[model samples]
Target: MTEVFFYHLQSQPLEAALPTLVERSLERGWRAVVQMSSPERLSALDAHFWTFRDDSFLPHAPASEKGAADQPVLLTTDEQNLNGAAIRFLIDGALLPADSANYQRIVLMFDGNDDDAAAAARDQWKVAKAAGHTVTYWQQDPAGRWQQKA
Candidate 1:
């Protein structure tokens, strides 16, 4: 069974939150596929990853990039895990994979302040639970720390 994690972003935006989470996934020696809501977002995230930190080098590239399967992180606009990633980072309310078993963990990050995003997360959480996946919700506390709420 795939472990589904809902990260409700309240204190940080996607640009501010994604890099660290992706980095952690890499630290654990797990490849990651990050799918954004739109192609525009995918391009933006590709640039964001390059410049997120001056000294940090996140081994990532766009899905269309050459030799993408060799990268530790791959950015795309769909559920296809180009890099054989065990972790899937779905940002901007992207849809979950129909067969989530392909991933060891699926992290859905949605903005808490966005009404549509919040509703989508809630709906997905219910669907994931009904499907027998282990679903956990983590909300950001006032201090910007993640606290598991459900």
Candidate 2:
């Protein structure tokens, strides 16, 4: 079984929140794979990870790139866990199939400002719950701290 988490982005964009969560995953000794809704987002995401912070960088590679197996973080457009990732991040309204047993956790990060993303998150919430996974919803408070809503 997988623990499915939904992160509703309001104050900060997904780009900012994703790396923070990925850092936590790395600290927990977990390899992470970020699945975008399409392949076109790969280059931009790769760049963003490298320069998201002036003093930090999240080491990552595209799934099709070389040395992916050695990367702690991977950006991809598919469900292939080539990097042996225990945690997976679903972004840009990407759909994760019902079979999530391969991963310990699956995170759905959607921008509440984007109508498509918000709608997608709602659809996925139903899918994940119907699939019998432990579903949880998290959102940032006024102070920009994470709080579990449901």
Candidate 3:
């Protein structure tokens, strides 16, 4: 079953969400893919994953030459380096769907205020629901309280 996960960036710290998401994926033995805008944020996430010796991290490098379809795709917005991993596009509160064949669960991490990020997340949530995939939303209150709603 395909699963879509969304994190609403409310009052919660992004750091607090990573471990929870990581644990959930590990518990289910799922290949997780995360899409984000800031390279610094991605780097922080990579650092968080280091705590789990069993996890592997792939940072999107971005693709070179816009028309070159044969090259490896990277998610980085930096047009100069397009030779990384596949780019995961985010829209609002939705997450772009990954290749369902390779991944069982997808966790999208993004700032709630980012318009594109939120839209992508919402789109992914709809897609997952239509596909009968489980969907979960995690958000934080202004007080730094974490809340997970499905």
- Winning model by TM-score: 1
Candidate 1 C-alpha lDDT tens digits along 16-83: 78899999999999999998879888888888888999998688988888899899999988777878
Off by over 4 Å in 3: 27-31, 35-44, 47-95, 142-145, 148-150
* Candidate with better TM-score, 1 vs 2: 1
Go through the candidates in order and give the C-alpha RMSD of each one to the true structure.
1.0, 1.2, 7.5
Relative to the true structure, how large is the alpha-carbon lDDT of every model? 0.89, 0.89, 0.50
Clashes of 3: 23
Give one digit per residue, the lDDT tens place, for model 2 in 18-131: 889999999999999999977778889999999999999998999888889789998988787888999999998788754587899999999888898888899999999888
Task: Please give, for residues 1-150, the per-residue lDDT of candidate 3 as tens digits.
Answer: 645556677664456555555455445543333445566655555566555345644322223235433333233333232232222233223335435423445556667877876776677677777777677887777776557876
The clash count of every prediction, one per candidate, is 0, 0, 23
Model 1, which residues run further than 4 Å from truth? none
